[model samples]
Structures are given as C-alpha cells and as structure tokens.
Target: MLEVIGLSSAAQTLYAALVERSPATLAELGHDTATAARLEELGLVTRLPGDPPRYVAVSPELALDVLIQARTQQLTEARHRIAQLAARFHRSAPEQDSANLVEVVMGRQAVSRRFERLQREARRQVRVFDAPPYATGAAGNAVEFELLARGVEYRVLYDRRAVEAPGTLATIIGYLGAGEQARVGEVPVKLVLSDHPMAILPLRHDEHAVESALVVHDSTLLGALSELFEMYWERAAPLHVRRGRLAEATGAAEARRDLLPLLAAGLSDTAIAAHLGWSDRTVRRHVRAMMTRLDAQTRFQAGYQVVMRGWLAEP
Candidate 1:
C-alpha cells in the first residue's frame, strides 16, 4: 500500500484545486479557499493586479521550491530563538532555581545551590527547621555573614542529635556570638527549612541519601511550613536571649516580646537543634545560661518570669 502522508486534508484539497485550475484566482479556484489563500500569501501562488485579489498557482517546480524555502526559513528562525533563550536561562539560573522545587539533593555542589537560595531570601526574618550544628559549609557561612551585614533577621531551630558533631557546635556558637537567633531542640526529623524560599537538609548524616532536601516558594506551602516552625519554636527551650533582652522577667521590663510561644510548643531540645542547625549541648548551655541570668529555677519558670517581666523585648 502506497500511503500518502504529510499534507493535511485541507492542504491536499487546496493543492488539488490548484492542479484543476492551474491559472485560476483564489475566487475562481474555490477548492479549500482558506488553505489556498494562505499558500498564496506564502508566495506559493502569484496574485496579479486586478479589481479583487486574484491568485494563480506557480508551476509545480517553482511552487515546491518556494515551500521548501519557507520551511527552511521557519527552522532557522526557531533555532535562533532557542539560542537566545538558552543564554538568558543560564544567566538567571541561580535566582530562578530558588523559586521552585521540594525534594532531596545529593552531592556538595547541589547542596551549595540551596544555601545560595537561603542567603538570597533571608530578608526580614529567617526561621530554620531541623538542621545540623554545622549544616552550612564555609561558603554557606560566608553567605550567612553577608545576610547579617545586610540586616536580615534570622532564627534557627536545631536538633540535639547534631551536638555529636563538634564542628557543628562551634559553628552554631559562632552564629550566636554574631547576634543571630539560634536555638536547639529535639526535632521529629533532621532538616533545614526557611520562610520565603525554603530548603531542607536531612539529619541522618548519611552522605549518600539524596532524598534529604526540599525547597518551596509557593506562598501557601511556605506559610504553613512557617507556622509549623513557630509551633515548634514555642515549645523548644530558649538557648539565648531572644528579641534583645536581659533574659529575665520581673515587672515592666522594656525588651520586645520574645519567641515565648515557640518555646511553649512541644519541640524537644534535639528536634530544635536539628531544625536550626545547632547542637543539643549548645542548646542546653544557652538555656542554662538564660536560667542563671534570669534567676529562674526551671525551664518553665525561666520562661514564665521572662514573659511576666517582658524582658524578652528589651534591647
């Protein structure tokens, strides 16, 4: 069976019309007039000067040549357009990657991109969830420094498990010393989550699992995740003075309100440490320091006194 292919039904009809009336105008040809008219416009037919637009198909030899030329021009234009797009896509790759995704990433370089996203998005407030004590590498640390220099507020929730990593402990302490919000607690999972452009890291410490990351930019998703972080922050113990205060609560204190609600939530020290990339020991140390500073006997008491005196809001 010799199967004819390529030309659409309308195109075949138009071509048949042209063959029947070799020198007929569009009005005279009348076969698939719409298709024929389009072909005529593409210069497959010759339109002579007359009262109305009159069309006649060029010789077969000439018409095929014109069609081939038209197709070649179309392909050439498409290639050029693709090249331009590729150049622009590479230029905007970093910023654009931050706006999408929710999954795990393997390899150091792939992880680097997530860090870049956090640095770029750490604007007003940066809340972290389930991270390592030394979750961020040197490049990541530098980015955090840049964020601090830019006056971007930050909050971290760390898992107690990360305390095992001494390097992570030092990193968290350094960030605290630099005046960023950091806390330690027990988390259900080990991951790093952000607000606007969020990223997550696994807590297992296994370098092979690529299923340990997540990134999201959708407003609803991020908001819900932020609420989760807040919920955890409430129950988690305070490792340092939050919102700039003396870590005490007496009467008519002048500090701004701290994240007391977060501390009130059920997040444990280990979970808290994981979320913010801090160690459990660091979390405990900060809490102990705060307790001593506030003259409170227990965690609840310390939190209560601070809230009562409103010292959490102090500068």
Candidate 2:
C-alpha cells in the first residue's frame, strides 16, 4: 500500500513504526531523520514544535485521501491521453460494436472463431484458461505456433484434469518447451485474454461448456478477471510431469500433495473442486479414499493422519 503511494520501503517501515509507536522524538524512533522528514513532507507525519519537539503520525484516513485524490487525478489524465492515442492508432469501428463493451458470442463455433481472431489481433500477450468444453476436436487450440515465432507471449494455465486430458499432452508439452510458460490448477470457466484490453469469460461461471461467452472490454470486470487469473496462476504449480506415457492411475500422490494445504485451510468440497478444477463428487471420492488409506473413520482422523505423516511439512 505504501509502495502504491510511492513511499520507499524504509519510509514505509519508519511511518508504520511511528504510527504504531507514536514516537515522541525522531531519535527515539531510531530511524534515519531524513526519512522521517520525507514522511513529514508527504503529510504522513507531522512535526510538532515544543521544548522537546515531537513527530506525530498523521491519521491514515486523512493522508490516504490526499494520495487517493492525486492518484485518481493522474489516472483520469492518463485515460484522456490513452483515448487520444487510441483515436489516432485505431480505425473507426461500427457503431453497434462500439456501443457495447460486452458482446455475447453464442454457439461453440462462434466462440472458436473469436478465439482465433482475438489471438491474431492481440498485440503482445495471450492468456488462456484451458480446460473442458472443446469447440473443435482437432487436439489443439485456436492459437497458432506462429504466435510464439513472432515473439507473442503466451501464459496458459491448464486445469489439472486438462493436463491429463487425452490427446492433448503432446500439444501441451510442445507449448511448454517452446517458451510458453504453463502451469496447472483446478480452474473452471474457460476464457481467453488478449493484450487488447478485453477478455472472454464463460457466460456460465460454474461450467466449462462454451454454449456462450462474454467478451469483456476495458472495464472493472476485465481487471477483476485478470486479477483472478493471477491469483490462480500464483497458487498453481508449474507442470513438471514427464512428457508422454499415460500412467495407469492419474497419480494421486502429487495431486494429494497439492490438495492437502487447501484442505488444511478448510475450504469446502465445492470450493476446493472449483479451485482445483475437479468435480465436487471427485473431491468427496478423494477424501473417502484418503480416509480409507489412513484407516481413518472420519475426515478428522484423516486430517490428523495427514498432519502426523508430515504432509503439512510442520517443522
């Protein structure tokens, strides 16, 4: 938060200490006097004059108001400038298309067409949540290999189920080795994000079937989707499973390793399934299996067994 307001790390640390401790003197605070003075200049701290002078921490409510206003003003100006640049760079569009930010593309074929078009039109990055609900049965996606050849960055996150998805492993492996950064997690709702300030999220939030899709333009919703993808991306481990060779089992050990912490964190069956991109029934099945493995009669006992086995990695 301090960094958002352009405060240095040292300045933030000192300001926090001052706010919490209410240091009567800079010397007592035991921080660089220059940093305190900088904070004072930023209206984060106030120096009260006295025989024994003191530095007072300003109320964050007041200080942050000033910062927020400044940032808002700057963002407004930036929007104006971006609008101007966009006007110059972009061709005039159809009135109907321009009027609507969210365009609903119906049917699987239309969605696939949009995917290809978005990829080609994108200037820099392409983000995709690859999972079920295939529009085409060609064993690959709408994105072309020419994209990477031309230096377009691809950040694709696959559902754990999708990584083991039939006829898709070799394609995923090619993408992973060909400079496309990939990771796997349980992600529902298939969508594509292009560099052109828009995203394609499913009309249905809970399912992967692409009967329809919402093309989200530059809006708060688009920003939130980007953030959501980032949150999933951060939690998702990079795919390290060896290429080729379909194992007899889907490999529960690794999957269990990933599932334990979320279980420990007390996420519900449905919530865990949503994050891991598995079904609720599948999650319950796994829990039952885990309970049986540990010879536990209850979820509580299974949890205890997981902890006892150092599954939580407690030191």
Candidate 3:
C-alpha cells in the first residue's frame, strides 16, 4: 500500500519491521544499509549515531502526511496534464474520422475507472440506465453522493431486474432519499450520461462482467440517448420514500402506503419484503389487504389503484 506513495516494496517491509520493533540495528531487522538508507531518505526512518547505527521508525502520522501531500500534488498536476490533452483531442476531433467519436475502453478496471471519471466530471446532471452486470459488487455510488452534495442532479432509470437484485432496492431507496430522481422500468442497456458531451455504455459481449465499454461523443448520438432516457422516464414509474402525514400514520394504512411504490414498480412480494425488511408472510398479508381495500381483484389493478389514489406522492 505504501507503494502508492513512492515507497519500494523492500522499503515498505523494512519500515513495517521498524514500526513494529523500532531503534533496532539494521542487521537485527534483516535489512541491509541500502534499504534503511532508502527509508531514511523518505523520512520514514531516522538513523542515530552509535557504534553500529540503529534506525528508528518515524511516527507514521507525521511521516505519511508529508508523503500524502506530495502524492496529492503529483495527482493534481497529472489531472492538469490530462485536461490539456483532452482539450487538444477535442480540438482535433472535427478533422478526424467520424469513427473517432466513439472510443472503446477495454478491461474491467479501465471501464470502471472511466465510468467513475465521467460521473465525477459532470457539471449539471447524470442520467443513467442502470441494469448491471456490475464490474464491482458495490451497490452504491460514493461519487453520486458527493455529486448530490454539490447539487448535481441525478436521474436514474433502473430496470425491474436491477431493482429485484439483492440489496439493490434498498440502495436505490437510499439514493432517492438523497434527492436522486429515480424511476423503474425496462432499461435496454447499461448506460451513464453526464452533463459533459460524452456518454458511456458497456459492451455486451460478456453478460457476467463489464470487460469493455464505448464512450460516445457524437452530438447526434448523445441527443438520441437523451431522448431515449426521456422516453423511458415518461413510461417509468417514479420511486419515492413514504413521507408526510402518511408516514406518520399508524397500522395497516401506513404499511400499505409504504408498499405502494414497490407495487407500482411491479416487484414481487418476496422482493418487496427484502427491500422493506419485512417477512414474506407480512408482505403477502399487506398486499391482500391493500387489494381488498382498493376493491382490486389482482396485483396489477391494485398497483393501478395505488397511482389513481395518489398514494405514491413525492416525499
């Protein structure tokens, strides 16, 4: 881990040994003078004058702070260079072939990093078609929360399958609570569109992993994607947290009200129960009661009644 801050593997090992047992002779730590000298140069170890000089590990809290600062500055400079290169590329894009508008990013890590960078660079909003053969198991986007805090809007359209995936509905609910505008419907592809002039969609050669992605920069293609999102958004059912007087209500009314969005989103009882942390039996009971109360004979009618009755109001 210390390699990220420019420490060699050997130096990191010597530093760890010194940290565990400090003020020891290099010979005792099984390290040569060169390794100890490297650590000392990095300000991670101190050499004291003695018959056979011993090295003391510097306080990690103090030593690592300087290294971290230097690393941060380096990263900042790299970002500047990347910005310059991107600007140059954009300037030359018009003279290049139309094929240059789509850049293929290969490998899972590369795809994931580009996705994160796209979201991070968004100036106004991000629209997503989130279906997921996820590159990472992480269910939530920490970058999204940061963007939300910065007042960047998020409009995410989740496929029903994505919502039904383990722990996904709960995570979606968390994003909704954080002011994301979310809806549930059929998402044809896994896509992310930022306010920037680019959009990314994962290539579907492998269904189990996001091994590659295409970053599209063509204005016509981007406009089509934006229209596609709107079309889906119009058909998708909005998802929101239960709130206001209904939230403060008690008993079956509150329970059924809480279940409205899940029903509207067409989740099965088991999926809804998992999302709400309720037993399967409890979810079934509520669905039956809610249907009876609405005079609906089927789950579909019951969900329609929920919307007609305006039970899924914004929180």
Candidate 4:
C-alpha cells in the first residue's frame, strides 16, 4: 500500500517495524541506515541525536495524510496533462488516419475510468442514453451528482426498460430532483456524450459483463451520436418531480402527483409501487382515482392530462 506513494518495500517494512516499536535503534528495528534515511526523508520517521541514533516513527494519522495529499496532487496534475494530450491527439488524429478517431478501451475498469474521465472533463453538458446491461451500477454514480452541483448540465434519456429495472426508478427520481433533465424512451444504444467532442458506446450487448467499449473522439460518428440524442430527447416525455400545490398536499393526492412522470414514462405499476414504497394495490387505487379525476380512461390519457395541466412542474 505504501508503494503507491513511492515508498520502497524495504522502507515500508522498516517504517512498519519502527511504528510497532518506536524510539528503537536502527539495528533493533532490523533495518539498515539507508532505509531509515529514506523513511526520514519521507517524514515517516525522525532521527534523534544520541550515542547510537534512534528513530521514532511519525504518527500515521499525520505522516500518511501528508503523503496522501501529495500523491493526490501529483495524480491530479498527471490527469490534466493526459487530458491535454488527448485533446491534441483528437484534433490531429483524424487528418492522419480516420481509424484513429475511435479508440478501443478494454476491460471493465478501463471502460469505467474512461467514462468517468469523460464526464469530469466536460465543460458544458453530458448527454446520455441510459439503458440496460450497464457497465457499472447506477448506485455508484456519485460523480453525476457532483457534476450537477458544479452547474454542469445533465440530459439523461432513460430507456423504458431501464426505468422498470429493479430499484432504478428511485435512482432516476433522485437525479430528477438534482436538476437533471431526464426523459424516458426507446433508446437504440447505450451511449454517453460529453459536450460535442467525445462519446462512448459499449462494444458488446451480451448478458455477460461489459468487457470493451469504443471511445469516439471529435468525428462524424460523434456528431451523429449527438444528433441521435437530440432526436430522442425531442420525442421523449420529460420526467418531472412533484412540485407546487400538489407537492404541498399529503396522502393519495401527493402520491398521484408523483405517479404522473412514471406513468408518462410508461413504467409498469410494479415499478412505480416499488419506487414509492407502496403496495401494488394502493398504487393501482391511486392510479384509478387519478384517471377518474382527470376524466381519462387510460394511463396514457391520464399522463397526457397531467402534462397538459402542468401539474408535474419542476421547482
């Protein structure tokens, strides 16, 4: 673990020994002078002037924190440099070779890292085609919230099937509450577009884990993906949070108001029930009441009525 911060194995072992038995002579710690010197340079150990100089291990809470902070700064700088290089490469690669526009990233961790970097580097917006067979769990996407808080616009188009997946509706609702412009529709592919330059799409659609993906740079393919997102976004129904007068109400009224977006998104009754933590029968009752109040005979009609009345307005 200490190697991550540029500590040699010998130095790490020496530091561990000193920590376990502090204020010990170098010989007593079973490490040579060079290892102790290295640890001292890293501020992990201190040497006292005595007949035979003894070393004291610095408290890990303080010493390791300093090392960790330094390492984090170095990594951040490295990432910035890599981003610069990537931008330059993307600008020049197309003229040199058209095939260079799309890079293949292999392995789940690489794909996940690429996806995160793309989002982190976005200056304006992130457009996503969210569907099933995800490379990663939706719950682990804390980065999206961070970006949203930073005023980065997020436009996410959730597939109907993705919305109906177990525990996914609640997650989508959280994103909606966080100022994400969300919609539900038939997504033709799984894609993530950052600004207008870069996009990523999975290479495999099997039931197995995602093993590979294509990272598309500024190219015709990327422009087409951006257009594809806009096309679906226009056709998809916008998902909104329960707000205004309905949000102030309690019981069935508020529940029915909350149900409008889900219904419009074409989510099943079971999906809505799971998200609201209500029984299926109760969900059905509220749906029927809402339909009757709207004077609509079907769920689709009820959804249209709510949108037309502007009942599900954003705060």
Candidate 2 per-residue lDDT, tens place, 261-306, comes to 4454444676556556678898898878877888999766676576
Q: Which candidate is the best by lDDT?
A: 3
Better of 1 and 2 by lDDT: 2
Per residue, candidate 4 scores C-alpha lDDT tens digits across 1-315 of 779998999998888888899899987866799888889999999999997999999999999999999999999999999999999998997688777799999998898899899999999899999887766765557889999999999999999988877777667767878888888877988899998579999887766436799999987888898899999887677777654121222565467667777777777888877766777897798888888999999988887887788765633
Candidate 1's displacement at residue 292, Å, is 13
Select the stronger candidate by lDDT from 1 and 3. 3
Model 2, residue pairs in steric clash: 186-276, 186-277
Q: TM-score for all predictions?
A: 0.43, 0.47, 0.64, 0.63
Question: What lDDT score goes with residue 81 in model 4?
Answer: 100
Q: Model 1: per-residue lDDT, tens digit, 1-315?
A: 101223457665666676667666666655545776666665566766777566666676676666666777888999999999999999998676655545556555566667567667755666665444334444336666667778877777766555334355456656766667766565655544554566555524565433345555555666677677888777565555434332233332211222342343334566545544557785576567667877988877876776576554444
Candidate 4 lowest-lDDT run of ten: 241-250
User: Which residue pairs show collisions in model 4?
Assistant: none
Candidate 1 Cα misplacement greater than 4 A, ranges: 1-104, 133-140, 163-170, 193-195, 201-212, 241-315
